[model samples]
Target chain A: MTGLKLFSRRILPQLVTLAVVVGLISIMFPGFFEISIANGRLYGSPIDILNRGAPVALLAIGMTLVIATGGIDLSVGAVMAICGAMAAWGITEGYGLGLTLLMALAAGLACGLWNGLLVAVLGIQPIVATLILMVAGRGIAQLITEGAILTFNHEGLIFFGSGSLFTIPTPIIIAIVTGALVTLIVRRSALGMLIEAIGINLRASTLAGVNTRVLLIAVYMASGLCAALAGVIAAADIRGADANNAGLWLELDAILAVVIGGTSLLGGRFSLIASLIGALIIQAVNTGILLSGFPPEFNLIIKAGIILIILVLQSPTIRTMVIFLSPAPVSQADTEKQAVNQ
Target chain B: MISKKALVGAGLLASMLMMSSSALAQTVGFSQIGSESGWRAAETTLTLQQAKERGIDLKFADAQQKQENQIKALRSFIAQGVDAILIAPVVATGWDSVLEEAKEAEIPVILLDRMVDSSDDLYLTAVGSDLVHEGSVAGQWLVDELGGKDCNVVELQGTTGSSPAIDRKNGFEQAIEGHANIKLIRSQTGDFTRTKGKEVMESFLKAEDGGKNICALYAHNDDMAVGAIQAIKEAGLKPGEDILVVSIDAVPDIFQAMAAGEANATVELTPNMAGPAFDALAAYMKDGTMPPKFIQTESKLYTQADDPQAVYEQKKDLGY
Candidate 1:
């Protein structure tokens, strides 16, 4: 009963939403669920979701933390471009895999530190603080590449993008390991509660000796780190770094995934796993549109329509209405139980 | 007869005017629409090279994609009394006033690579490649390669509803309208990016019997083609062998892919718009002759046979 309660409370809604989206896709293309191994790697629509969703899923993990701290990192997409360019530049210049990865990480951390300084130290609004980097970050990336697509043929670094581990793609493996590690770091220690506490009431949390300022900066740094990893994967995936288009407008997708996962932008409680699932849902819809053979013009419209339906279903009143409208007649006791579950 | 001598006299006057114009190097001003992409950068580099070769004094302005900056540059050129002015307008509208200012100063204006909404009389001539023609070139290449053989093609389009995306799709469809043997089995937008192109192609390979059913791929741009080639390679299928890859915008990377025989062909969206614009301005300066209102640059197609390595070396330095 405890396990059932935990499942219902934590992951059920996101799983249901994912299942519904996958069902809709399979309806459009009957072979959507078929998975086959080719070239010693898993190949199918499902694998595509997890593999393609890796970058955003990683971003969502970091975004969930920042959003929990009542902040947003709009510069993540640009940070991705910067880090990807750095990696591409490094790899092409024969910096080797380890040094390239380290350089990219440092770039990401530096961008995050800058953002944290502006927001936490300077007392600027999170949106305005990150917007500075969001605007100038791609320009910085372009400058690094001298305004071109920096291509690389480094096999060792490219493995992080397309290589697989025992039939699973490398991106999927990286995302899962990162997500699990982040989840353990937060959940295993008092870090999760401190973040939630800060989100709930910053001044009070500070008075309670939560070290709000340092924590806030650390949260933003974590987000930056995630964006850096995502950037490397994206660059490696294409075997080149496209400074202009690498992570264009991807921050919005990460935010949308967080919101769709039922994490409130208003701050407070959050779920890392739920947001990861949200990323997969978004990718599933994208993959579905591709497999559906729809005209390109309808891609955004269809995606928007489905997202609207999902959002509407997520509303508290709509969710309650949906439960009430079900075949099981709800008594007063059941209503109270449902309310308690919510 | 008197009429024959009169014609000779008129010819002498024209020749003298041409000689006088050629004796002095013309000073012209160029306002480019920023280095927004590698292609635009290449256009800028080539424009500078073309000016050097013709011994024209070119005052270049980087407008950075702002109409106001372009307007300021035009006004400055007019003040300096340039021989002619060339502009690649960032946006289509809001050029009437500055163009009129140039007209009042008697400075002939030539538009490059992009069109303005102002009247044709406001500028000397507009030089650009037809985007629709670019698509048709790629499609026509596939049709010729297939040679009436039954084949299936998948297309990776540009951003949804974008002008290039819509026109390129329509143009490809138009070129293959009567070809029953070639079918566009699947079509999707790659948003003119490599990541989306690769992702969409992976799905296409899976859906079409692990790519066994697909015979060719057409991308709206070389970046997408470069990406789709990688996808085809990862699927354990030889890209140029198993499936023909054709795309538009012959960017430098595409040439590298072509050299390696990963990509089959690419239609060049030539960066030489400035070459023709300069020629037209020079012609007008020499004889007061009015060139055509629209000058279409050639949409040259390059294949493996075209020595992709040499082309790559040539374009790599152009900042593309």
Candidate 2:
């Protein structure tokens, strides 16, 4: 497909929604988009949105794959807490930065392997398998931190959360790099097709000699690793591991981002760039609400209203209705192409 | 009423004589809410420390943030025939039956850090800081520190609609009500978390002319204050000097901030709720004095003038 046609077909809807949100925010606060530099780092509301949205964006990258495989991982948030606690514990124990990160990622891998085993080997439902860790993972994290916010002052480790490169925040850079690498790997190899096939029909994909078991485990492990990265960033941002609040209820946000990006929860094709945009949309609304100076009580109501409008605009029924009402006539081939793309 | 006073006086003397014999071996049961936050954890630690200092045979029960578990622990404490019981109830409702049982067992139940919805007479007294008073103390500190300067204040509220949030906001507003020099420019909820606190404060800084317009910040909790402090520093402003930081809940970390001159003042929602409860119990045991229905713990305010580092050291090991 031509780049313009591809952009118009797949990316335009989300981009428009994002633009509208940003436009509304800019209208409310005239300097919403103005970027300034301070302390050798980019500072502005836009940068804040990108920086704050890093965790969700990272999760969305992995979540897109999991959802595309027809499996849900409800344990990312708790995994975040677990990995953060591990990192905090390791740092405080005088471990080097490398060792602390390795331990944290290892913890994530272990959690992912546990969930994978339950789903792939025991034939448990994805939701149930992850639900176990979703509940217990926070407790494990609490134990690791001894039921306190484990504070660390390791500068090397803190750099990931707060340090900047080229005046851009480290978190933004990390998210971009992680997204690009994951996208390249999945698209470069046949792994994407195999995962999509398994999602479409697990029995058929298994009969077709796709290593469904190993692929399932690998997919969950990827999700776990992404969650660990998010956890580290969150912990590093605050310089502490808050077992109770770290990544609490963020799995839902990641899932919402995936759904808002036009990916089906029932499984099939997925788009990482769209999901990243959806994460940004969520953060933009958040930043807008904060800047609007509305009462705290109205925050949720306003966010819910804006998100509802965005979803309604993205609804397929409304899209078709808009097409039907359009002045321009669409050829049969173009209409068929639109349907297949969706 | 005069005759009743005489009769109570007589009863007091009679109980005092009987209580002195067993005073050294007094046993108490403490039912604590789970360590949900640093403050709650500190309360648990202080309770244990208080029990140990008094040489009281203390049986500690963790309710795990469940009303059911608290009720169960209360029943078991009553069955054990403890002299007095201290409970930090997880919730207000569903305590009528449990309190009634404790009363029937002749055990004085003193609530720690939280109150129950049962009749006042059901329990001896509830010892907790006045949430509104805590907020007002924080606000009053800001008002005094501003010294009639035309200062714009930004508030970091707790979870929306929470009792502490509402009461703290009200108390602060009440404190600065007549101060025309002070104005609340913006207010938002940070959900009482560091992450949300930092994120919300960043937007506040952006909206308020990059932290120049705002002169003070009031957070409902110290954690949020700490987060906002970071946001202020990131915006290239000195937190304590450029914008005064005042918040409630003197968690250990806040003292660290204060020692570093990053935070200005904090109103302590003192976790030593058990200290007063135990004192009242001791007084009641020594003489048949009925403690007040409610005991308001002190909402002490700490500023940079105070020895914040010493306080931090004292509180650091308290599990906060």
lDDT of 1 by residue, A1-342 (tens): 997688578878889999999998888888887887878998888988999999999999999999998889999999999999999999899898999999999999999999998988898999999999999999999999999989998988899899888999999998999999999999999999899888889889999888888888999999999999999999999998999999899999999989988888977888999999999999999988888888778889999998998899889999788778888665767889989999
* Quality class of the docking in candidate 1, CAPRI style: medium
- Isolated chain B TM-score per model: 0.92, 0.91
Lowest-scoring 10 consecutive residues by lDDT in candidate 1 chain B?
A: B7-16
Whole-model lDDT values for every prediction: 0.90, 0.90
Native contact fraction, candidates in order? 0.92, 0.86
lDDT of 2 by residue, B143-163 (tens): 888788899999999999999
Please tell me which predicted candidate would have the highest DockQ against the true structure: 2
Per-model DockQ against the true two-chain complex: 0.64, 0.70
Model 2 chain A: lowest-lDDT 10 consecutive positions: A324-333
For candidate 1 chain A, the 10 contiguous residues with the lowest summed lDDT are: A324-333
**Candidate 2: stretches off by over 4 Å:** A1-4, A327-342, B1-24
Could you tell me the lDDT of residue B35 within candidate 2?
80
Docking quality category of candidate 2 according to DockQ thresholds: medium
Interface RMSD of each: 1.1, 0.7
Error of 2 at B109 (Å): 1.2
